[model samples]
Structure formats: C-alpha cells, structure tokens
Target chain A: MTDNSAHGLEAREDEWLAVRCQLGERAAFDELVARWHEPLWRYVRRVTAEDEAAREVLQDVWVRVIRGIVRLREGSKLRPWLFGIARRALMDRLRERYATPAAVPLQDFDLAADQDTSALEEDLASMQQGLEELPVTEREVLTLFYLRELSLAEVAEVLGVPAGTVKSRLFRARQMLRRDMDTKGRPV
Target chain B: MNQTNPAHPGGSPTLPDVQRLLDAELSLRSRLGYVALLLGSLGMAALAGALWLTEPALPFRTQVAFALMIVIGLSWTVFSVWVLRHRRVLYARQHIVAGRMAVAFTSVFVVSALAIGYGSGKDGAYAAAALGGVMLIGAVLMLLRGHRAFNRLAERRDGLARELGRST
Candidate 1:
C-alpha cells in the first residue's frame, strides 16, 4: 500500500479505538496510550523544553484525551487533536511556571539577507545548536512542521494560531537558524 | 537544559511506564460509571418510545403516553445539561454536529407545535411558548461557534494531509 493510504488506514484504526474507548473499553484505551505515548512525549518535550514540565503537561493531555475522546469524530484528525491539547496544556503550565502577568510575544530576530548554502547544509551538531538558538515559539513551529512532520495546519492547530501565522513563523525561524549558522562560522 | 536535545529530552518515561500510568488511572470504576450513564440514558429513551407506540385501545392510555414522554424528556434534559457542563473541551466536530442536530430538532419541533396550536385555534399562548423555545435554540447555536473554528482548523489539516501524500 502507498504511504498515504497506510496512514489513512492507521487513522481509521485510531478512530475505531476511540469509539471503543468511549464505550468504556479498557483495552482499546490501552492501545491508544501505547501507540501515542512516545510520539506525544517527544512532541511535548520539544515544545516545553523541559522534561519535568513535559511530563506534567502530558499527564494533563491524557486526562483531557479521556474526557474528550467521545467527542472526536474523525480518526484522521486524532494526531492533530492530541497535539493541540498538549500545546494548550503546555501553555498553561508555562504560564503557571513563570507567573508572568503578560503573555510573552514570539520574538523576531534580525534576518541576515545573504545566502549561506554551505551553512544551510550543516552537521547534525550545528543544526541542533541552531535550533536551540531560536525563540520558543519559533522552535515549536519549526519542530512541529519539520521534525515532527506535522502539516502546516496541524502545527497551526496545535499552536492555536492561524495557518498564515504559522507560515510566517516558519519562514522567520529558518532565517534565524541560517543567521545562527553564519555566526558560528561553519567552514564553507 | 540548553545542552540537551529537546527532541528526546532526558528522564522521560519509556513506553512501558506510560502504559502502566494509563492502567492505574483509568480504573474500573470510572469506566463502569461511563457505561452505566450511557446505557441508562438509552434504556430510558427506548422505554419511552415503546410506551408511545402502544395501541390506544383503552381510556387513559393517551395520558400514560403523555406522562411517560414528559418524564423521559425531563430525564434526558437533565442528563444532557449535566454532560454539557462537565465537558471540558467543546471544540470537537462531533460535539458541534450534536449541537447542530439539537438546534435543528428544536426548530422543527417548535414550528410544528406552533402550526398545530394555531391551526387548531388554541390562541396566542402557543406562539408565546414557541418564542420561549426559540430562546433555548439561540443558546444552543451560540455554543456552537466553537464548531466553526474547528472547521477552519480542519481545512488546514486536510491541506497538510494532501502535502504529506505529495511528499511521500
């Protein structure tokens, strides 16, 4: 089977599991937890940038998943919905962690206009460092869109932002990463 | 923290631990509670339907049907209201569809009730009652705005799904 068709089938299975779960089937729920736990953990870890916070956020997400599973109609949308819940939980935890009265705006650092093809194709270590240099919002948008391979809309849903906003965030994030690469002076 | 690869952060639980947590927290009691709630509501509805469908062979049978309808309808109202209040996430498409179905049903009922009331010349009271029902319908439709936002998000999801197919 083609990859997309396979994904479609897997999503249908998730939907079936979700319907069974809503009917109070423990085994179905167990399968859901088993299937999604690692990917969710990784997504939450990347988004929150702290293992402890990610763990807490994940617990909250699962609690909500249990409560909200009955309402999820489309199985294909399950992954996006789970990530969206995690993102909201992570935001709540961040708010509580900082106790900051005002929301932090996503930063837009200066973008260097010059092209750096060599830097663009950097070693894994430098790429990791480049990612670390980005703001939390930029990093999250990039990670969800690129590393996690979530569609732009899925990332936008997770972040509770417009698709247009996600596109701009992605563009700016890549630019900032390239700028960081240039500063590190990786050999051409 | 900065040195760590955030993608695979340190100290996160493995798959086994996650399964254990799910097992512990999703206990039998909670699952049973859900099953009981759903089954009870459905049973009441089925009983009401059966009572309504019985042949009107004797006097007071109509009264019995009316009484059963009122009781079952009230029970469903209370149950649904409680469920809605306790629901934490209202953005799911399923919930939206339910809400829309509710609004449509209420609208149809009110219109038919009004037609029967006035067509039979029951006076202005029937119109007044229908207006009250309209207010309830308004409230339900208002709560359904979340569905619109969800649809917008779903559109994006479709786009991404398409993109994934092309890339693959």
Candidate 2:
C-alpha cells in the first residue's frame, strides 16, 4: 500500500511536470520525453514489424505531441493517449505498406531471446502458422496479446473491438495455439 | 541537396530531410543558448588568461571564476559531444541527461566553492559562479529543446546493425 502510494505521488509529480510542459515550459517536456521514450519505442517496435516504420511513427507522434499536447484532457491519461498516438501512426503505416509478406520470416523476430530457443522457435513457428491459418480477427488478437503485451482493454482499443470481443478472440486464439502446438509436439 | 535513403534507392527519404524541414520552420528562433555556449567557452578562457596576467593582487572572486570557467567549459564540451552522439535517442533520454548535467554542475560548483577558497580566493570565484550558472542553465535549456525537437525528425537508418537485440 505504501509503495503504491509512493508511486502515485511520483506519478502526480510527473503530472505536475506535464502541466508545465503543456504551458510551454519546454524543460518539462524534455523530462516527459526522457521518461516515456523507451517504453513507447518498445511498444512501437512490437506493433510495427518494420524497424524503420517504428522510428518514423515515433518521430511523427512526438511532433503531434509538440503541436497538440495543450489540448489533451485527463492529465493522468497521458500514457494511454501517447500510446494511442503511436498506435494510430502504426495503423497508418500498415495501411501504406502494400507488399508486407504474409509469411513473416522466422528470422525477423529475435528467437534467441527465449532461453529454450529451439522449443520456443517451434512454438512460435507453429503459432505463427496457426495464426496465419486462423481468421484475421483471431490471428490479430493472439499476435497483439502474445507479442505486444497490451492489456485487454488496450488491445480492444487498438483493434476498435469491444472488451468482450477481445476476450472472445483471445480465448479462441489460445485454444487454436494449444491445438497447433500439440500437433507439432505430438507423437505420430 | 536531396537527402538519400540508404535502404531503398529512390524509394524512402532520410532523417536529414525531415530535420531540414523542421530547421526551416524554426528559422526565426535564435539558438541563443547554443551561441552562448560557444561564447561562454571563449569568454571564460579569455577571462582566465586576463585574471592570471594581472596576478599577485588577485582577489578571491577572480580566482574562483577562473577555476569555474575551466571546469564549466570542459563539461559543456563533453556534454555537447554526448548530445550529438545520442541525438536519435534524445527525445526519450533528454531529461535523464539534463538531470545528470545539472548534478554534474552542482558537484563542480560545490567543489570549486570549497577548493579555491582554501588555496587563497584568487580564482575569481564570484565571476565563475555567475558565468557557470548562467551558461550551464542556458546549455541545459537549449540542448533539451533541440533534443526534443530532434525526435520529431523521421528515422530512416535501417538494417540489423542498429537493433541491439531488444525483444521488448
């Protein structure tokens, strides 16, 4: 409880700083930028498979913040709002990318990060294959949940789907992933 | 001149193009802070030389100022290099760097305050304090603003060379 409250105080301090930022207290925005850049970049990287796209989108998002941070309501909702900006930029990229190979190569995602690299590779391959084989809704939910680490509510926001729909898609996707993984590991 | 993208020839544009666009937009703002830093280094060096030349009757304040000018000038130089190196990550890391710069100056301030006084206050400490404070504050402000604005420029450098194995 104490730790949570401490965190809340720190967050409030950041909000105070953010208020200064909105009022053209340029220093405060530098602080805000420093504070949020990494996670935002990580999030952008995950959502946009293309590295260049993530970089481009993040730059655009910061430009938007510079131009429009004053209009943001709900001070504490800054994180979500920033996330929304990055996600929108990503969606724009997705729309623009005409020749994205449906078969996302295995080498694309860093497979070596998992300690059990071989098993994880097989699992990911099976999962990716299964996802490609599944309906787009199910595939997208599974990918976003597994790869992006977005909360259910946030996932729903990204997909423009209801929370219930996100849950349903997740449930169905999980069942599919399990079946696919089992088939790969099962004895013939 | 046109900015070229390394990856796709005649396909995508580089970050410099975007930066050029922004620079044009912000043309009127006299990077006063950057100019101050350039002048700060030169001014400090000249002041230190003048004070030393008129030595023997040097006051405590002048001695202190001389010491501070040397330290602040070097710190600013190092800081400029660091900023240029981390320009791409500038937006996300500006504050952290700013805090560090502030802390670094604070440490130097305390050290100069104590050290010069013990060695006979001929270092122009008062002038040093004022000069360092003003320039440090200015550099911090300007670099941070430039840093944030730099983040707006589109990043075009690609290839596996830039990826640092960050999965998250």
Candidate 3:
C-alpha cells in the first residue's frame, strides 16, 4: 500500500479509538494507554531528561487527555492532540520549576548508560546523550519530527504554530543537533 | 528507546499505576454521585426557597433558618457542578446516564410535590410543585440533548470503523 493510504488507515483507527473513548468505553481507555504509552513515555522522557519527571508528566498528560478528550471534535487529529497535551504538561512543569527556587537540573542522568554494549547501542546512547545536551526547543522539534515521527503538519498542529514556523524550527533544530553531536564527538 | 532506569528498576510507571491514578477521575460511581448530589442540592434549595417565599407570618428565626438552608444547599449545588464540569467530566454515555437520572429524580420530585400540594392544600407545596415542574422540563431537555449527542458520536464511530474495515 502507498504511504498515504496507510496514513489514512491509521487516522481512521485513531478516530475509532477516540470515538470509543468519548463513548466512555472502559476498555477503549485501556487500549489507548496500551498503544500510545511507550511512544508518549519516550517523548516525555526525552523532553524532561528524567525518568521520575517523565513519569509524573505522563500521568498528568493522561489526566488531561481523559478530562479533555470529550471536547476533541476531530478524532483523526488524536496524534497531534496527544502531543499538544504533553507539550502543555511539559510547559506547566517548566513554569513550576522556574517558579520554585533551587530546582536541580536532571539532565546529568544518562538513560542509556547501562544498556547493552553493542556498537549500535553505543552509537544510540551517544546520540541520546547528545540530544539531552541540546536546547529544549531544538530537542523538542527534533523529537517530535524524527523520534516521535509526526509529520511536519502534525508537528505544526502540536506546536500551535504555522507550518512555516514549524519548518524553520525543524531546520534550526537540525543545525543545532548536528553541532551538538559534533561537539560531543558523535556522528550526526 | 531504552526506557529502563538502573537506579530504580521497574520504577517507570506501569499501565496499572496509570490506570489506578485515573481510577478516581474515571469512576462512574463518582460521576453519578455528583449528579445525584447536584439534583438533591437543587431540590433542597428550591424547597427551602419556596417555603421561605410562600409561608406567611413565620417567625424571624424560622426565616433565618430557611435562608441558611437555601444558602447551604446552593453551595453544595455549586460545588457539585464545578466537580462534574472540570474534574469528573461526563462523557457521551455518562451524559446519557446523568440525564436519565435527572429526569427520573425530577419526575419523582414533581409528583411528590403535587401530592403534597393537593393533600395539604399548602401554597408553599404548590410553589414547590411549580419549581419541580420547571426542573422536570429541564431534565427532559437534558435527556434529549444527551441522546442526540450520543447518537451523533456513535454513528460517526461506526462510519469510521467501517471505513477502516474494522468491526464497531
């Protein structure tokens, strides 16, 4: 099948899940968490750079999703909507952390340090380390575009920015990631 | 991505933990409980207010007490409304259930008010019956609205499922 057709199918499936959720099907929610949990966890973990903080943010994300899903008019936009909620939760956490003094940065904690020592794993670990060192905005666009694999339009929707703005951010994020990786002696 | 944490193995929140966190918010019992609380509070306030307005030659203390009851009932009503709107949101199915509850409760209230008004021939009971009738109308409207919303969503759900070649 063509990519467009596959994407269309995925969208329909997302809408199906969303409609079931809005209908208050308990099992639909379980299915929702099951399907999106790992991807969302990876997104949150990458953005926050902390396991505990990611867990908290993810929990908050689900709370918002549950309370707010009924208000979602277009269920096909669930992917971006979920990411948007995650972004909002991240922003709220950032605001809270800024408001409170003596907030310790958790970036030093390496997530892939203790993983398998294969060559590919090492490369990915170095890349992950490089990603953590980038600015939040750059890291975010890269994660949403590449890691989470949202289309440019979807990324624009999640960021609530114009498509042009998303393009510019993606371009700048790529440049920044390349430089950060080079400085860390990791291949881009 | 490797999501494991060496410091706290299995520290990442499992699905059950997330579900448990959402348990209170997703509790059908809690949502319906709020609905009942809202209806009961509104009923209490209406009754208190009706008595206060229609009863003549009442003592100052009784009037004060009636006013207090109205205020207390209204406070509870407001709290319940806030909780339902913001925290324990009612989804399409839940909305239908809540609307049915409202309809049944208001119907009973109206019938009871009518019986009291006819049996005791009290002006306050008649006023309460009028208020109950208004509430009943609102409840019926709410139920109809819920049905419309649910049917729309269900139809769309089925359509999407069919398009995706999946069972509804």
Candidate 4:
C-alpha cells in the first residue's frame, strides 16, 4: 500500500509543475494533465456519467489549461482550482442539456447493492450509458469524494467554497442520491 | 459516493475502459520495445564479436564497459517483459515512480554518453545517438506529467488501503 505522507509530496510537485505550466511550458501542462487526468476523468465521469461527455470535459479542461494556466501560477491553488475550472466546463454543458435527467438510470441503480468500490472494474460497456443518467449534483459530489477521492476540504477547494459547506452539500447530495436510488428500487 | 446500493466500487465502467485502453497501448508500446530490445542485443553481440576478431587484445576497461551495457540492456528487456504480464499488479503511481526514475536515469546516462562521445561518428552512430536522446527527453516529460495523476491515485488508494486494513 502507498503511504499517505509520501503522497503529499506529489501534490507539492504538482503545485510546482503548475508554476512551470503557467510560464508557457506545454510540457509542464501536459504533465499536469497527465498527472490529474485519471482522477479528473473519474470525477467528471461521476458527475456526467457519459464517457464521451467526460472525455469532452477533460479535453476542454486541457484547452483551458493551455489558455488559462498562465493565470494560475499561485502554486497552492492548482488542484482544486483546476477542478473548479472542470466543474464550470461541466456545468456549462449541463446547462445546455438541462432537460431534467433521470435521477438514476435504472441499470445503475440496479447495480448489485452490496458491491463495493472494487466493483467498478467488473464491466465497462455495460455501465457506460447508465452512468450518464445520474443527477448532475450527485455525480459531482460522488466523483469528488469517492472516485477522485478528494477530501471534503479539497472538494470545497474545487468548488470554491468552504469545507463545511462541502460536508453539508455532500450529505445532502448523498441523501438525495440514496432517495433517488431507492425510488428506482435499489437497496441503497 | 453514489447511492449504488453501497456496493461494488471496483466494478465501475470507467476503470474497465481505462484498463482496456492502457492495456492495448502497453501492448503496442512493448512490441516495438521488444523489437528494439532484440535489435539492441543483436547489435551488442555483433560488436562483441567484432571486438573479438579485430581488437582481440582489447583492454579490461573497454571489455568491462561493453559487458555492463549488454547486461543492463538485457536485464531491462526482461523487466519490461515482466511488466507486460502483470500490468494489473502495478498501480498508476507505481508506474509513475519507476517510469520517472527511468527517465531521470536515462537522461543522466545520455548526457554522460554525449560527454564521452558515445559512437560519435561511425555509421548508424548518429541515428542511434539521436534516438537515445529523444527517448531520454520523452521519458523525462512523461515522468513529470505522470507524477500528478499518481498523486491523486495514491491518495485514493491510501484511503482504500486504510479501509481494507480496518476491515481485515
């Protein structure tokens, strides 16, 4: 298993890399992207649930990184700050598609209720379209918490809010998602 | 975090997709890598043979250096092959560590090689030298970028490990 404190160093290096990226180093930006892409993708996937949409959000994030990274040289603000940018990019699309998506697509809510995190890898093609149907807020909070594994504080950082708010919002989001899943007849 | 019946974390669709993509890419990458390794071994053997025929009285220093390169190159090939078979055993960040270290080591080696004028002017030497240089540069870049992704993964895995430890 990986050490926690050792992982802290990685965040520091990412901050350092972000500083380099702001200086027009495409290599640094790619490094930044490469470093964060999977988590970000997982986060976005939770929020959007659509593989193509998540990919689009990630691609847009990269484009923004190219254009706005120079303005983000404040070292400590990269991770959540970048996540915030991703959130906005995701939100913009959500707004365009704001037709009231299903609370939880039937298949997703039906995922064997007792399964755990390791279960996400059981099948890819089976769950792709189902994930896209989750409520956007549920998707976001879940992605930030479980998928990307950011702390409440970091999720707040990404959302540009206080950590306390992240907790409350996450609590509310989870409750709502649970209610939604139960309504769809899942064990929740 | 999703209300997915509080079950099945690893079964997410995204993991499989990423795994599939990574597996396919790793396969293609190592095929070319295997070819390169084969050619490298053959070339090194040929060099050793030529030395035996034309410079039979080569000094101990030259002989040791040649032996070292051949050994390192062959060992790397074996390790790379091992990596191919057990790709799932390696987490994202572990790849970052070893991969980045490799880049760092390669650059250091290449710079030292350049300083020593490794194959400086013989036929195919320039191409070989440039190939090494590019490989070194690319690895450095990958290592730098891979570190960020690895950080989040490590954090997530840390949480999972802790939870698992608690469960056990």
Off by over 4 Å in 1: A1-7, A101-126, A185-188, B1-9, B30-168
> Every model's DockQ, to 2 decimals?
0.11, 0.02, 0.52, 0.01
Q: Model 1: per-residue lDDT, tens digit, B1-168?
A: 123333444755655555666665555444334434433453344334433444344358676765676577558656655654354223244445445555654555457546766787553436434553764466487546646655655554445446555220
Q: Which candidate is the best by lDDT?
A: 3
The superposed Cα distance between candidate 4 and the true structure at residue B121, in angstroms, equals 59
Number of the predicted model whose DockQ against the real structure is largest: 3
TM-score of each: 0.53, 0.39, 0.89, 0.42
What is residue A65's positional error in candidate 4, in angstroms? Answer: 1.1
- Residue-level lDDT of model 4, residues B24-83, one tens digit each, is 433434444543454355345434433433445678898787677667666766665554
> Which of the two, 2 or 4, has more TM-score?
4
| Per-residue accuracy of model 4 over A1-188 as CA lDDT, tens digit each | 36566456545555566645433333454556556766676676667765567666766665555446545545556777778888989877777787664453322233234344343334332444434455666456656765444656778778776766565555555555555546766444
**Which sequence of candidate numbers ranks them by TM-score, best first?**
3, 1, 4, 2
Indicate the docking level reached by candidate 1. Answer: incorrect
Model 4's DockQ score: 0.01
Candidate 2 global Cα RMSD: 18.0
Question: For every candidate, what is the interface RMSD in angstroms?
Answer: 8.5, 14.4, 3.1, 14.1
Model 1: residue B142 alpha-carbon error in angstroms? 25
- Model 2 TM-score relative to the real fold: 0.39
Residue A22, candidate 2: alpha-carbon lDDT: 45
Would candidate 3 be rated incorrect, acceptable, medium or high by CAPRI criteria?
A: medium
Model 4 chain A: weakest 10-residue lDDT segment is A105-114
